[model samples]
Target chain A: DTAVSQTPKYLVTQMGNDKSIKCEQNLGHDTMYWYKQDSKKFLKIMFSYNNKELIINETVPNRFSPKSPDKAHLNLHINSLELGDSAVYFCASKLRDGETQYFGPGTRLLVL
Target chain B: QQQVKQSPQSLIVQKGGISIINCAYENTAFDYFPWYQQFPGKGPALLIAIRPDVSEKKEGRFTISFNKSAKQFSLHIMDSQPGDSATYFCAASTLGGSEKLVFGKGMKLTVNP
Candidate 1:
């Protein structure tokens, strides 16, 4: 079984449009995270959730909001997506006490 | 500022050769260091990891060398094969609490056969 899974493998949207990406993990992890990989392949943390509690909120725009309904799911919703929002969004999860994070197949977002 | 910095953004090596990637971190609190390998269209996967307590950790052809005082670490791939070509990212995280991982700009490794 896929330990971590993400939906909408590819997203092509226009500016001012809103979109959402979904993530799910079956590894029974307690912490889930969202990372953004830019065109330069630089990966940076966006948001983190521990058992549905917001923990780390990086210097991301307010347009990007992460919602975790449960421990197994964390979804990202962007309001009025901009051109700079074009990048790969990855979902990762790991045990609360562990350091290893398993990543899901990234969702390629292209905001035109 | 980038907490963890990686060197040689890209490298090309011939098959059966050795490929080395280096990384440096500014945070002393970072106790967990890991290397993640990612293929095209795929998410990064954990390759190998080490802690400040150890200077070196080897698993098969992949090895990680860490220097706590200098806050430096490296990944060495022995007998690099074409199948091993991928982008490798060096990351560090301090355990406990949120444990947000800091990753360096990945290094793209191309192994030519």
Candidate 2:
């Protein structure tokens, strides 16, 4: 069984469009995170949710918002997506705070 | 400010050779260090990890060597095979902080048979 899974492995949309990516973890982890990998392959943390609480919010633009309905799911919603938003968005989950994280397959987002 | 810095952005190794990737962190507060491996079109997976208390940890052909004093760590792949070709990332995190992991740029390793 997949410990972490993401829906819509690939997303292609036009500018000014809003889109959402869903992530789910079955490892019973309390902490879930969202990371963005740019074209240079530089991975940076965007947000982290622990037990449905927002624990970390990096220097991301306001257009990018992360919502966690429960401890097992964390979804990313992008508003008025721009071309610069084109990158791979990854979902990761840790068993607990400050522990190893397991990543999902990743969703490739391309904003035209 | 880049907290973690990795060296040799790309490397090529022959089969049965040893591949080494180095990383240095500026934050002394970081206590947990982990190495992740990623293949094309996939997310990275944790390969191994180490704490500041230990100098080295080994699992199979992959080993992590850490130097707390120098604030440096490295991942060594022994007997590297073609299947081992992938991108490796080094990350660090603090204990009580936001628990946000700081990742290095990443190093692409190509092992040729």
Best by TM-score: 1
Q: Report every candidate's CA lDDT.
A: 0.95, 0.95
Clashing pairs in 2: none
Reference-based TM-score, model 1: 0.99
Segments in model 2 whose C-alpha atoms lie over 4 Å from true places: none
True contacts kept of each: 1.00, 0.86
Clashes of each: 0, 0
Q: Please provide TM-scores computed only on chain A for all of the candidate models, following their numbering.
A: 0.99, 0.97
The candidate 2 chain A region of ten consecutive residues with least summed lDDT is: A94-103
